[model samples]
Target: APAPTPTSTPTSTPTPPSHAGRVLLPHPDFRLFLAIDPRHGEVSRAMRNRGVEIFLLPPSLHDPDLISSSSPSSLSSSASSVGNGTATTATTATTTTTPNTPNTSTPPPPFHEEVRLLASQGLFGSSRRLRAAVVAAHARLAAACVRVHKRPPDLRELAHFAQLASTLACRGWPALAALVVAWRQIYLRSLGLGGADMVVGLRVLAQMVREAGVGSTLGVAG
Candidate 1:
């Protein structure tokens, strides 16, 4: 008998993400943070040239609740955790992850509860503000990578976010770092809290990037 020929399975081509509707403008302060000119056109090229291999801060390593919220199993887990208050007091940020839905397995880091304790120290108008700021830098990076592209990020975009994050996270951000350091000094003065306070520092990050403005602005709005 003749040897059987090997069969090849057909592979499907992945569809490219559509650049439809409108192109979103990247945030200005964020552009500066990455050293890209705030002006539009050739944005992607600029990012590549910047050689963005950034720092991944341990504090913002992974947001478990935000990551888990996207998981199908999260609802069930949340309900079950009701009996285990040990899980309840762990985190503070309530924002959604953009670009990439992070791996839920990457357990939330310790400061997950840091914001809550810092809240009572009278740093801001509300603790909610602190929470938002904590994740603010991460959120801006997500948008820059692809979330603001007028559609959900594809695998390629998500990968881009991860790269951008790693580079951005490792290197100290001048503006953001300075603010954090200054606030920490003030932290000693007012609250007598340690010089590692993140409340004010995080807020400075949030202020730099415009949240959700990418999709809303119609150049010809009446």
Candidate 2:
């Protein structure tokens, strides 16, 4: 009998052994930030914000202390007030009482609090999507590189392949997908999936550019 006909939805192809490479790479979230184009400045910024959020708040999902700690100056003032329970007034001499001065003593929110707020808002979701996208981009690039017997790809190159291939695959392009998958396979074989996990973020961005097609390229247009 002939092999059974395959019948899975087009959402995702079979993810070949994702564990091929064994080296520990950087946090996948961090790598995603590097893969986006600054030319798509807004998207790139969002991705970075999300990655930072995930790193800062992975386990707790929410930190109430951080929420209340946002206003650094106010919190400090409150603590001081509780400690001293008294106010000491100082005399001020002003040459020009007619002019009004702006208040510069207010402190900005704690930087980490801002980051936490951004993370809670799904800031890092796109970055995660980008990481998954690399699955396709690497495949295509590896095939092309192999045909030419080019140098082995780095994490950045692999990421570019995944970015390009996945974006194209989403748009109903099988040829592009095949190339991406093939290239990624080669990359995986060389380093083992686990090993590839430790690549830097910037390198991942370079890879995305390398594998980007016209649409994906345009997505990052300056």
Candidate 3:
């Protein structure tokens, strides 16, 4: 057999580990936890130019319950009815269609009463941070009310402010009492309300603050 031809087995090449699967890697323009308050639009832009990727921590990440009450159907219904009354009648060539609206046609309850009812129901969620924020905001509102009215805030007023703070916290924003105070001040100023007249303005101010704080947070820019 002529030296039985030397048999050689081919060696298989080892595949290198993929960078795509690696958990950690070095890269420019890394994610930076800059507390950039969205209200400060100018500062935010400046930071973005410095190779810092601003990562906004969404409320849902921390508190899934933030949008738990906001079901698609509920949102759609709320959207369709906002500022247009409960039912909007559409006139067509052949027929008029009036979508079946919820019983919201009834005038909303008085603002203070509504707040009291919400508070009684324990509308606040179960987050320690949220609770603390709400308590601080409530204290601030109470103090402001005392300073303005020369008297302690009524139970309804306190409840209303507490409800506001809790709502803001639940939505994952710092329940800033200063913001609420500013909102009330501005509304009162615009209405030229003084003393007792300011009490009535709370309803409008609450609505304004709630609308403004939607999908908003507080933090230092840059």
lDDT of all predictions:
0.32, 0.37, 0.39
| Candidate 2 local lDDT, 140-210, one digit each (tens) | 33333444445435555544444444444444566434444534454544444333232322233344333
Against the hidden true structure, what lDDT does model 1 obtain? 0.32
Backbone clashes counted, model 2:
38
Better of 1 and 2 by TM-score: 2
For model 3, state the Cα shift of residue 52 in Å. Answer: 4.6
Top of the candidates by lDDT = 3
The per-residue C-alpha lDDT of model 2 at residue 206 equals 40
> lDDT score, residue 127, model 1?
22
How badly does each model clash, as a count of residue pairs?
12, 38, 0
| lDDT at 161, model 3 | 49
Residues 1-222, candidate 1, lDDT per residue (tens digit)? 999999999999987668646669868766445533222223576667866645433332244543323222222122221223453322323445443543112222333333322222222112232233333333333333242233322333322332332233234434234334433333223333222223322343344222211111111100
- Candidate 1, poorest ten consecutive residues by summed lDDT: 213-222
Ranking by lDDT: 3, 2, 1
